[model samples]
Target: MTPPPGWYRDPHAPHLERWWDGTAWTGHRRAPGTPDVPPVPPAGGTGRAKAVALTTAGAVLVAAVVTGAVFLGGDDDEAETKTGPTATTSSSATGLPAPSPSTSEPATGVPDVVEDELNGVTFPLLDGWVRPEHVAQDDVVMTTDGTYDCPGEGSVCRHGLVVSRTVTATDQTSPEALAEEDIPEAAEDAFGEDALGQQPYGGLESHRVVKSGPVAVAGRAGYFVRWRVTTAEGPGGYVQSLVFPSSVGTESPVLVRYVFDAGEDGPPLADMDRITKGIRPVTDADSGGGVGSSIGPAH
Candidate 1:
């Protein structure tokens, strides 16, 4: 594992810092009180680490960013200390910035994750993402990078970000059934009719169903679908769907929908994956119920 790029406590010295150039430990070391000094290798420990890009995104990176972790040996709890440098400086080896790439820039302060429980499932919301003004249902929790332009020929768009998730139990629902009901129908409205089956799911701004495959949702066999739709705000990213069996009394199935817009910087596929994979049903042993009933709509 490539140690994150930062100034961590020099295991050799109590308050001194060693720069982790996102690869191996750099001979570069810095002391506290001084922010502009160069890093030099401390007293001991040879420096060598096979490194990868610092842009790999996920929970591990988030954890490192949150705690401002130091590079002790990977998986080695022997030399860790509770201290770190408190200044802004980049690594001489990797030239990467302090903090980390996974550090979020949400409207609010950065949080490891903003989480909530809905429809008997608990999941994390993106930090700084704002709640949508409207939702399909109260039980549906919707938040976005920012306000979406009003829907119009060209003015309406989900520019940048739109994250919404909801769980609904019908008489019954399945992966294929939800796809049949939601995908083709929605694409038809965005484009003409059968736009999904007629063409690829992405490009052209016209809505389309691009790809699909079998997936496991909440440990149940399910499916996932990706869609591209036209928006006035900007070209939209993919809207994903996950349908699976509800953890309820073993009858009602659940359907969860996701609409993501990562912004001009491109879709935040990593953040989306983190949130999606974090979903879990509250079991009877944990929450005492199957799935919770809808309260109202998002407002």
Candidate 2:
């Protein structure tokens, strides 16, 4: 029997024939009873032509597979490059540009304002008083009115001056308002009853109610008041407290209180007299020539 038009006898098996349609072979089988015939050459030349056609078709299939693989690999590489580690998301969840190069440098310039050596304590030898030794250390400057066998002792020792400036507030109320308001309980714990009173000195015109007294060293004026009470140190201590406001409207004032150790009679009335006299108001165009002077000492 003749085989189908597109069928060929298997070269290796006599009983089986395979189908070779235009393209690849079909692995389908014929019935066992089907007769097998040797393939005949075409009019043009059969074996070589058929072999060449089959070879060319196989080459095309290989090329297609290879091309598809290459295309898939290239796509994977492109995807990896786009999502690689160097790329990052911003806090806003959007991709951001890279940071710029830095050119930072350390700062250098003038120093901070500080007190000079003589800035703290000094006595310029006022008339009718002698500067004493015990309170005349570089840290403390004390001046006295009367004579005493031992310095810083005795009621006849009269007045004593002790000056200290710190960035602390001894009173909860302002120095201008201290005498008028009840003393804060905390102040009594540290400074005692003598720490009361508001004495007027001089102040800038803007501080209509606050007073300022003589700060002979810096030409600053502050308020002065006497606290006739005992201290953490001793009994019968006299404190001629001076308050220098930090600025026209600031709350905290720099206090320079002079503690004198002059018994129950307190420092000679002369000592208080000297302090009141020495306390001068700062004279400035804005001062209004003492319009807001404190009526008596600040409470």
Candidate 3:
């Protein structure tokens, strides 16, 4: 049951104490022994718990932004640290921001749009795609439902994957530089060797740049680099790294990576363009920022 209104360890910053007003975390914080300030009133009804099917819409990319361990590691341990909605209070001491409740009904279906509010953007869910579960550290990720036994032993790999996250690991701001630097690592994470030394695509042998240059994404200027990767084991696919200024917040660089298996088993290469064109600021929906789309059950 939700604990009675009181102070508790701050989930975002364990070094301090924060108030939990019987329903949700509040912005009020204090040192362990300091006198408690009046608790902030809870907002409306209780917020929805974290969804098992998808990450929170406003999930922030705090802490380590990118690490080898985060790329499709498929670890259950990461899920254990995820908490419910963050308080909407403007206090900076509240640690990471909490997600607003999702509008999609609690059903075994896919929403037409998926949001990464922390980065201030939304992604369109295209045909043959669904929100990914268990892909650690990706602020927003989706993949084709179809999967096959990984060429490497002891794991499964999806045929297509798309991931977007803020580039918090560096202070750099140029989208071109960030996109170029991230593609190689993105390719390695998808087709090359993993942390466990498992070559999911039989080890990325080489990559040929298919396209590289400036582009537009989500109404922001961006840059993208797409490569056709060759693997030693399976038919390798295409990988693209696109970086753009976030539509909201500090305008920190946001990275969107795409991976698709080669040939018929993977999503159409055109999907990358479709998805890119479909991205928009979450505020745009009511302002004509989005196109008409249909919601469907997860495949």
Off by over 4 Å in 1: 1-118, 128-138, 151-172, 186-205, 230-233, 262-267, 284-299
How would you encode candidate 2's per-residue C-alpha lDDT over 166-248 as one tens digit per residue? 22213343454432221121123113321112111110011012222343222344455554443333333444445444332
Residue 270 in candidate 3 has what lDDT?
85
Candidates' C-alpha lDDT: 0.37, 0.29, 0.57
Error of 1 at 220 (Å): 2.4
Q: Model 3, poorest ten-residue lDDT window?
A: 290-299
Query: What's model 1's TM-score?
Result: 0.42
Which runs in model 2 stand beyond 4 Å of their true positions? 1-128, 132-139, 145-159, 168-173, 177-225, 230-237, 246-252, 261-267, 280-289, 294-299
Q: For residues 92-185, write the lDDT of model 1, one tens digit per residue.
A: 3234444322111121242333222223344455554444332211112334544443222322333323222222323435666664455543
Candidate 3 CA-lDDT value: 0.57
lDDT per residue as tens, model 3, 1-299: 12345555553444566666543344566766655555544577333233111122223222211212123332322221122222232334233333342211111243677665545666778878876544433333566775677654436677887776656535678988887777776777667655555555567688898877776676677888899988777777898888888777677777788888885677998898788877777666433223222111111
Clashes of each: 16, 14, 1
Q: For each candidate, what TM-score against the reference?
A: 0.42, 0.31, 0.63
Worst 10 residues of 1 by lDDT: 61-70
